[model samples]
Target: MVINLSPVYIENSLLFANTLVMLAVGLTLTYLTTKVPNFAHGSLAMVGAYALFTIAAIMFGNQLSQLQLAQPLGLGFAAAFLAGAFAGLLEYLLVLRPLQKRGSTPLGLMIATLGVDLILLGVLNIFADILRGMNPVTGTTRDWRLKAYVIQKVAGLSLGVWISFGIMIGSLVALYLLLTRTRFGIAMRASIENPALAQVLGVNVDLVNMVSWILAGGFAGLAGGMMAFVQRINPATGSIEVVAVFAASIVGGLHSLLGAVVGGYVVGLSETLLTKILSDITGVNLVTYKRAVPLIFIIVTLLVAPEGIMGINWRRLFSRIRSRK
Candidate 1:
């Protein structure tokens, strides 16, 4: 079947895919360190989004010029990252850490994340109300997006698209270097591989775990900041988006960082492009139901390959196929 490959569709896919890559990586990082799925992870992304919005609102008010908007882009992202990192660290220390010390079961810890998510959501709502009262840009506190200010393009793509792609590439490269070339990275890897052994060998496992959460939150924040350019920003935006983030991580294999990257692109592109294709053929608008794509991925991955993409033994499967041929 012939399917159109439009520029708009490609841009949308890349923007989403890049954002998912950061989020999936962050989710995997935390899971590796703490061994629990963090439901509040998405809320952390909204924190970053709000940080970016606050900066933008403070600097230019509601009437933001293209140049003015571009000026604070970097600073806003930095603020978002710091804000997200702080929130994540607080969650670990105040809630998860204390619970772990008290010997909370995995299920209990997971439920604690739900509580954290609700708390963060309420805080975001309050913050939005305060922003509205301050009147820093009309409607800046809720359903905010960069569609109006996104006037510039580079090489026929929105500048936001390039920025998202750049962030994804830079984050991956930095993570690689940090994990492979730095002493802390080595220690962190050791902790992930075997916390008891690493602790016995003089590695500070707690420190490593703390750092992982920081990195995870920072990444999520960065992704959320980028997300403002593509999607509407609201206090609950992250909660709605978390399903896709979890899908990417689970499909990639929660135990494998590389799997997150692969899953992010696969799920991101399929969600956008496949939805478009089906919509075109069926003559109906299916964008609202696009989330089903990721839900399907999660279910299929669980049933067919519970360990996800990284769990498959490709070489063995390939040998069997060759023998059959």
Candidate 2:
């Protein structure tokens, strides 16, 4: 069926997909390093968003023309990355590391991540209050969005879309080079593959894990900074959006970084498009329920292929299907 969608919606979907790619990759990397799903990962993204907001507010007073705001927002991306990296590192060093030393079970570590998420959420709320007191903007503490300020379009799409797409591609290429060409990357691979053996081989597994968290957090922050342009940013925005991130990571194959990339686009586009399509057919507004798409994907993936897309033996399955035909 031909489904005509608005260009705006399409652009938003692509932008959201790109952001998910970064978040999913980060989530997968951290999971690989710690063997635990970080419940606090989304909060890290929010930390980045707030960082961007802080920089923008300070430099431009949270209200400015597109031209005037552009520079600070551009610089805010870097600030966001550092802020997120710092937060992730602190989580690992201050919370996870101590718990690990005490022989915390994987479940315990997972719960600890949830605790960390709550702590981060509280901190974010407090930060929002501070921003409101300082700026006194209408939406400073809630429902912050910069969509109006992003007036420039590239190839008929928002600049944020191109920026997010570029960052995702660049991050993947950098990760590829880091894993394959660099000595440290090789060591990191070894550590992820087999920490005990890597440790015996004189690779500092702890350092590798620490670096992984930093990279993950930085990617998340970068994505969050981009998100401020396209979506509303509140303190709880990350927590609400993490459902899509987890769905992408799971659908992509939690154990495979490449899978995370694939899953991000798949889930992101499907969530946006499918919701639109269904809404049109049913004559009901479904944007509020768009998140249900990712939840369904998670449930279906777990039930149909617990190992995810990357875990399937495609060649073997195809051969079997051919034989049956």
Candidate 3:
């Protein structure tokens, strides 16, 4: 059966928005911990998606079971969430911490993260090959069925968009609570500011950093799982996704959660709209370039403002500055 790429792109645009949430969380964590950009964050997402694949295979083969979905979706989300922290732990213990101890500049730490990213990429490819070669259930068929869950077709699109908006609002509330109402959030901010000061003041700086990573990674994992459910995950998918996420992050402005959210919807709408426009305009098919729009926009945005559509005045930042002034 031949699948039209336009609808695939449309669906994938939604999937990308869902997945970008994970990347935004990651980008936010990196901004907090390392003060240097992380290019390898995409690799972690790849890992999360693969982890879902592995779990899905182990739990369900050649059969699409709701139970199977929950098993991986639930457990895998926990694991993915931890993956973020583990990444943070590695960044702190192996890369940033050591480099900072040696007086290595932030640029060095950033480069080191890129190195970690590449190393993980190679390792993941090896895993991919191994998984590909060995079919655990040697002759088992793969299940590619989409469960028919929704009943109303008339309002599905509007419903989905509303759900997306609700998620955004909920995330904002949760983030605010964490940042302002929780001790751990306070510690995270403090450690981001001055680890030595935080440590001297008895804030377990190392532990807080670890927690942040775990939280960020796990969130990324869950996001990836949600995406895999909505789309499909292969062993070796990369910039195919990172590009869209980069766009959303840029549009949302790199460090702000709200920016990421707004950026996601913008990219989602733009993806659908662009494909429609291109399909009509040049008569050249845009299925190939639909996903690429986000990346292209990211580059364009960076070249222009680079500060992101939301700017740096995060809600938290605004509240803090107002208090100070």
- Model number with the top lDDT: 1
Worst 10 residues of 3 by lDDT: 143-152
Better of 1 and 2 by lDDT: 1
Specify the poorest-scoring 10-residue window by lDDT in model 1: 133-142
lDDT of 2: 0.86
* Candidate 2 per-residue C-alpha lDDT over 1-325 given as tens digits, one digit per residue, 9 for 90 to 100: 3466988888888888888899999999999987878888889999998898888767765446566755787788889999999999999999998899899999999999999999999999989987886553236666686566664787887777777777789989999999999999999999899999999999999999899999998988988877876788888888888899999999998999999999999999888877888778777888778879999999999999999999999999999999999
166 in model 3: Cα distance from truth in Å? 9.3
TM-score of 3: 0.74
lDDT per residue for candidate 1 within 1-325, as digits (tens), equals 4566688667878888898999999999999988879989999999988998888777765555576666688888899999999889998999999999999999999999999999999999999988885544435578777645663777888888878888889999999999999999999899899999999999999898898889899999999988887777899999988999999999998998999999999899889987888877777877678989999999999999999999999899899999999
303: Cα error in model 3, Å = 3.5
lDDT, model 2, position 209? 88
lDDT of each: 0.87, 0.86, 0.61
Error of 3 at 121 (Å): 1.5
Clashing pairs in 1: none
Residue pairs clashing in model 3 are 80-218, 81-218, 84-213, 84-217, 85-213, 85-214, 252-259
After superposition, candidate 3 runs with Cα above 4 Å error? 1-11, 63-68, 133-174, 190-202, 230-232, 312-325
